[model samples]
Target: MSLLGPILLAATLAVPAAFLAACFVPRWRDEALAWQWLAPVPALLAAAAALVAGPFDLSAPALKLSLRLDLPAALLLAVSALLWIAVGAGVLRAPAAPLDRRVAVSWLLTLIGSLGVFVADDLLSFYLVYALVSIPAWGLFAFDPAPETQRAGRVYMAMALLGEAFLLAAFVLLAAGEPHGSLRIPDVVAALPVSPWRDAALALIVAGFGAKMGLVPLNGWMPLAYAATPIPAAAVLSGAGVKAGVIGLVRFLPLGIPLVGWGEALAALGFVTAFYGVLVGVTQPNPKAVLGYSSVSQMGVIAAALGMALAAGDAGAPALVAFYAANHVLVKGALFLAVGAFSARGVRPGLWSLLALALALSLAGLPLTGGFLAKAASKPLFGYGFAALLAAASSAGSALLMLHFSARLPEAWRYEATASPGPLVRFWPAAALGALVLPWLLFPFVGAVGDALSLAKLWDGLWPILLGGLLAYALASAADRLPRIPVGDTIVVGEAAFARMLRVGALFDRLDAAFSRWPAAALALLAIALALAWAAAP
Candidate 1:
């Protein structure tokens, strides 16, 4: 490719890498934190450049690394870069004391990996960046001494490590199955359909990435982790970092070929997660926790769409999925920032509350909003019949969950301190506005603007939201009667099981101790010798 493309792509990672490197120096550490917001600028520029310049690849044979930016990656990268910039600025530029060095370093590391995943073209590089997005992010919130936060962090780390193992095994299978020994992602994926171990590899790939996307059975960490983190960190992690799994699915799945069984199975799982989030979220009192559940639900919608696309062998599904995810990247991050802003002590909760409400409802595909367009863009994948109905039902579920989120906000505002809000708090509205409008600007890249605004399309998006609103109102009186599911619903069960396992291990330790004692050891040896003598005589 041309030099401009490579340079811009290289600078996306290089700028963040340089800043992260500078953080090691005691003198430059403060400076690094001060200007950390500027790090994503290159990525933003690269994303914009990719629009006109088209896809480009940067390869380093010596380093065994390759990076490519295509339409799907660029869509996500651009929005994610914007989120990182806005939230990073607010966090780092706050009027408070300087941030802890570790948080700063972890932030940069996570930022690099978050952006890096979109461009990484090789299996090895994608795995490394995905790890970067998933692992060091523990420092973002786990530093708090709160017991719940610590527990959440531990669970988060365990899930991340588990996901890594799944992905690594899958990658190995993909590599082994490739006859040419090509390590490039496209090469491996193209070969996957014909690979001897195709089914096993696809299963692992779905499970590995599914964990990150908060898909069912593996989704326990997401809500807990998000609720535990500070708002700014939550915004980025929820928005940008989580999408690494999305990109993984988009890149690795052979969408060009139909896999009816796998697609349907994945779609079924996605729908389950989508509704499950709503069922549990309305009962939640914590606004942050509610939003966390909303993410689970929304991600499920995306997964479902992708799964349908895979079933039909729709090669164009990647761009549509990316567009849907791109809208989510902004809206979710903005919601977190809005939470921080609304929770500020001295701020009057009136006007900001309405703004926050609009942002929240947008997730439900509110008419003419970015979410509406996102829903519209993905409509082709769902088509008519049961899948289409589920998509509408998901919108309603999102609406119900988001409305619940808004209802929980007043309580959050009431308990806050009386201190004046920071610049970051004030910056929230701008971020919210960006989340609403930016998708409209980018919608043309994926589909026609006129189609999203059609009378029929508007009605399609609206009824579900209205139904959800009615449900929220009807349930408001009985919300307290709903059982309180913990932030990570299934995680409590897992933890209890682990505790029991530990007790079992303790019993084994005692048995081992008894067996190791002189009398028991001598008896065992004597018994073995007698048995050997008997056998020899025979």
Candidate 2:
């Protein structure tokens, strides 16, 4: 088992890399492109092995390879792998091969990083995989000629670079704090609380991962990016790619030992983002954009959960948070594919819309859905406090936003039928079905399914949804009165800031030109030499 564990871990990463390298060979490029979906198979196998084998470490002391698949990571890995496979199947099912070389390579690289993140044990490995998952995604949409596509690509890539900067700085501080020079996550986390750079590291860690999760200010890129990308790419990116942040929090933060101030601060920021996403989402007319805001909202809920757990000093919280996030990975991923499926059979009232509706509402914690199981399992961690009330209220907001999704999708597709939904329907529905059913299967791993179904518990899940539904109905007439915000709301500010930086660059350029004149350059060098000479003389 020990021997097989590291081999499986290595294979999971090696397979994608091998295929990605194969893409560069001209003769193999087409075939490699066609089989893009096959890349996640080894990861699926590795996740399964880890599920059975428990934590595994590679014996190479020099490489410092250590990987563990505890229940939290295993849960996320399984669903992420499943999302990749389902999306991949959708690609392969197309009559003509759907991938160009650029897209195919980008997809494979993103998949490798997405899956690698779950099992990454050390700081350097995590950072490299994290960058892999992040930076290459630009190629997915970068070449498109449309202005929004180009703009989305630019914004996304910029935000990704900014996030990488924050996380890299945090990792350096973390390594510095560790006297033993170990880069393993567990070791770094153990040293974080007492380390000299503890606050700085933790702050950067939260902001870094929070950017990936679509937390406010860092979030403006998602809506534009998703709306611009093709649906299948969006599916895996939303479902699998974003969870990298959640896992970062789960792995990086010192959750077991509570720091009340930091915890409360995180919880406060989370709640603000939670409400912010939904309120902004409600005004969005595009279903895809709505889902983007919803991601922001949903991720905020996850952040809030982590924050509360940290406040309580609960060691068991990471598992519960993982369980919640794992369900989202499936549900959100499936929802993206469902959008594609619905557009296929536009104007037809079939099982797809109904299924999509159920799935959308599931995100709002509809009773008996996987979301309910997730919410209930994590309920104890929130305890009886204002944070708990905020958690409950967030469900109302989820219900409201999802109801907006439920209503908007069918309306858009009611008259736009042209594409035959049948070709991809087979593949997409499998994802939707899996999302609905998998949480039930995973329930026992977190807590009992029966507890989620008790009369009181069912009501606990029911009221918020009812309130949101009623509010949604009440506001139906006033919907148009709501302001129409752009997809990336705060992005306008970011863009302006970037513009100012460019203007500053121009100013520097003019100064550099002046400095290149012989007299100017001679004076600068003479001043520097004189200062040095004077200091030495003194």
Candidate 3:
């Protein structure tokens, strides 16, 4: 079979989607939920095929749905597929509570988008896939309507819609610039350097993808969303859904061209976000919220890496960034799952929990783990410069935040029995094992395995971990002295801003009321028509 055969990719998406369609029959909804776990299998297969067979393209005759997968896309798709599978399995076994069909539907829709985004070969398909990934996931936030969840959902939706607006504008600008009317990403990007609206197009692209990537200022939604989600849902959203942005950046950004000013600006924004996430993360009490902040920080590091690569006009950066992001997909997903596991199956206070804790801390680039491999792979881009120092320091902050997470675990799990193993038996081990091993295996394909394991690399990975450990230990000793802060600090500030907007909304409501009066409406229409007539007269 051709490695990029549309059959496999189509099946991956279509089968589960067909099942979701079946859910319209009340009799099939439960059965469909049971089988939703199978939706990502085809995606997994397509990813494997793409990785093995190189890039391939397929197009439909009627709808013109172009499907293609390259090495970078396949790598991300594979990891994302794995996350969906693992999380789906966990969800199947989770305590039988009232299941939310809306959440399930959202999951399927997001899955389709997540899978499609990886293979979409043209601009219109990419936009459709991006929309699928962004819009439906809001249902995951809205399944239950707690204040935090509602607020988080609102923020997430707002950012997502804003991102969509920017990306659509960028896509429109890109299409307009294409002399041949080509909507293929490669074609558009090839023309971008010489395009008249290059600057505006790039700005829109950055803003659009940056919002999804949770870049600073636009990043407020992440902590709020992750903090409110169910553990399994959080795992997939954090691990897989967010990668839509990563892949978008990889595919959309013109890497061959050097745009020094723009690249440096992005890098600066990234560095600030990296440190900003940690600074806020340390203050938060919820482990999940801390992890969310950590994602913001880690993605910042990625943005910095991409910026450096762009500045240098390095083509090798995408694979390296993918490797880094792929590792994060596994580790962060596992960590979020671990939170649930540890909570359900009480850790025996000492070694067991400590080992789990240690593994969790590995997200901070702890030595001899997937996180280190990710960090090591990116080292070349940073190259012993200020960027390198900043990246390493971010690792230190990751360690500290993870330590706070570990400390919080005991309290969260205190009510459960330590002796009786719960769901963690099935869930945690798979997640942890995936986090530790998958990156190593994938490293050789994208990077040199020898570079990943060298003594110099080992030390580079080790010291930051050690520093974080020492800091964690010191904080533990002075635990009481630490002031308790709310999870998602700036989120509180954001909420206040939202409240202020509500007051503004009331004023706007009054304005609309006045504007809708018959005399006022007629007068506005007349004024607009006269203005148009005057402009046209010239």
The candidate that wins on lDDT is 1
Model 1 agreement with the true structure over 300-364: per-residue lDDT tens digits: 88889889988988899999999999999999998987777777742466887787888899999
Q: Could you tell which candidate, 2 or 3, scores higher by lDDT?
A: 2
In candidate 1, clashing pairs total: 0
User: What RMSD does each model have against the real structure?
Assistant: 4.1, 5.9, 6.7
lDDT of 3 by residue, 1-538 (tens): 5644678877866876896797678876777777777789988888888777777677784786778777888889899999998788656533223456777788889888888888888899999989999999988766675776787887789889999999999999998888998888899988987899988998898899888888888888888888887777778899999988888988887888888887887788889988888777777767778788888988888888888887877788888898889888888888877777666654455766766676777788777788888888888888788888988888887888788877776555543222212443456766787788888878877878786778988898888888888888887787676665565555567778889999999999999898777696798899999999999995
Instruction: Tell me which of candidates 1 and 2 scores higher on lDDT.
Output: 1
Query: After aligning candidate 2 to the native by TM-score, how far in Å is the CA of 148 from where it should be?
Result: 0.4
Which residue segments of model 3 deviate by more than 4 Å?
1-4, 93-99, 413-425, 474-491, 501-538
In order, the Cα lDDT scores of the candidates are 0.89, 0.84, 0.81
The per-residue C-alpha lDDT of model 1 at residue 490 equals 81
Off by over 4 Å in 1: 94-99, 413-421, 504-538
Question: Compared with the true structure, what per-residue lDDT tens digits does model 2 show for residues 254-326?
Answer: 9989889899888888888899999999998777788889999989998888888888788999889998999
Worst 10 residues of 1 by lDDT: 412-421
Count residue pairs with overlapping backbones in model 2.
Answer: 0
TM-score of each: 0.93, 0.90, 0.88
Clashing pairs in 1: none
